[model samples]
Target: MIGSGIGAPEKYRKVVVEKLGYVTGLQLSLRENLFDAAQNFDDLAKVSSELRLLASCLIKFAKDLRLLSSGPEAGFPYRE
Candidate 1:
């Protein structure tokens, strides 16, 4: 039983390493998306539409945060 348990840590380490690789890939993809959004605004109408969509997303996120932090100890406590 002790010998069998010896491989558990190795297996867990392998899984963690694999997950870190996946997270790194996702981070790179997000960075690429940000770069594209920042640099590729050629059309004025498209830029206006994208800006409106971004504003709406930000507004919704703010509303969600407000709703979550309604009570004193309900959600995340942010300090300014």
Candidate 2:
């Protein structure tokens, strides 16, 4: 999406990829411990909530970039 959306430079894109990797790791850990709390579910739920909060920001960023790449025409993908 980065390549087809904003044409982010390779170096900057690499940084985004690295950060996404961290997000993946956190997601996996939360999944593994999702039910470990059983009753309270405090820690796992907090981590999940925080991840989702961060995801909202990323979602907005992606949407804005998509709109920018699309300009006034939303009929087709930018790269095509």
Candidate 3:
């Protein structure tokens, strides 16, 4: 749905790619933080919450990107 809908419009396709890149960068940063937090278990709770938030955001970003990439001829793997 998204691929056909957004692909038909170049602007929407560009926006989706930009958004995906932004979220991917954030996920990388969050992964680095997890590594840093490993040495300071005292703040485990906060670190865990941050990790979860990042993961959720990353998942959403990926799903959206996938949707945007799906061609109208192809069946959608997700619904929004």
Candidate 4:
């Protein structure tokens, strides 16, 4: 059986005292992809837009909170 994956050895070379005990492994390369099928990006675009909106809202809320609790004589000062 042949195996292939991320960790699987793709290509290499080694030597041993042949004609005693040996086995051979070979791999063939075929590059004949004239055109890869088109992939839709609409879903990705929508998710990116959603993330941008959420990030923008969170950033604005954080800025507002910082402004509210900033200077001692400004928005709201913490008494200690």
Candidate 5:
């Protein structure tokens, strides 16, 4: 998606891939602790809320970029 959608260079793609791996590891760690009854539910909720905000921003940025690049001879000439 990053490559096709944003015309991301190889270096940028590598950075994105590394970040995604880090996020996946974090999610796995969170999942492992999610069932602990002693954990603070409010703090978990706040973390979830922040993740949602991050997702929203990423989606909006991708959508906006796609829109800006749409139409021939108007923006980026993304090859299909």
Candidate 6:
């Protein structure tokens, strides 16, 4: 009865919100990890390459999620 208007399924809206939260967390974690990697780059010289690549991948994923979450009125508009 709460969401008795527009079409889109409530479950789908919940899924999108959940995904946004997850992506936010991932972005924060990736930022922290990237910082740590930079700080210890000298100590972990040989493994820096892998760490950099991993950080790059995480950043890309976060960016993609951010784009997906953009324009509430346009993409997957959900009512609370």
Please name the candidate that would achieve the greatest lDDT relative to the true structure: 5
Which candidate tops TM-score? 5
Query: Candidate 2 — what's its lDDT?
Result: 0.59
TM-score of 2: 0.40
lDDT of 6 by residue, 1-80 (tens): 12322465657655655786797774321222434555555655758888999999999999898778767666556778
**Model 1 CA lDDT for position 73:** 73
Q: What would the per-residue lDDT of candidate 1 be over residues 2-79, giving only the tens digit for each residue? A: 122334565664565477679777432122243445666555578899999999999999999988777767766657
The models' CA-based lDDT, in order, is 0.61, 0.59, 0.61, 0.51, 0.63, 0.61
- Model 6 stretches astray by more than 4 angstroms: 1-44, 74-80
Error of 5 at 42 (Å): 0.8
Instruction: Output the better candidate (2/6) by lDDT.
Output: 6
RMSD, each candidate, Å? 17.6, 18.7, 21.5, 14.6, 18.1, 23.9
Over 1-80, each residue of candidate 5 has an lDDT whose tens digit, in order, gives 21142354657656665787797774321123323534546866999999999999999999999898787877667689
Q: Estimate each model's TM-score.
A: 0.38, 0.40, 0.39, 0.42, 0.43, 0.34
Using lDDT as the measure, name the better of candidate 2 and candidate 4: 2
Please give the ranking of all candidate structures by TM-score, highest first, separated by commas: 5, 4, 2, 3, 1, 6
Expressed as tens digits, the lDDT of each residue in 1-80 for candidate 2 is 21142355656655665777797774321122223434465766899999999999999998888777774467345574
Please give, for residues 10-60, the per-residue lDDT of candidate 4 as tens digits.
332112213222444444232222122123446458999999999999999
**Model 4: residue 21 alpha-carbon error in angstroms:** 42
Residue 76 miss distance in model 2 (angstroms): 6.2
Separate clash counts for every candidate? 0, 0, 0, 0, 0, 0
Error of 2 at 30 (Å): 16
Indicate the residue-level lDDT of 45 in model 5: 90
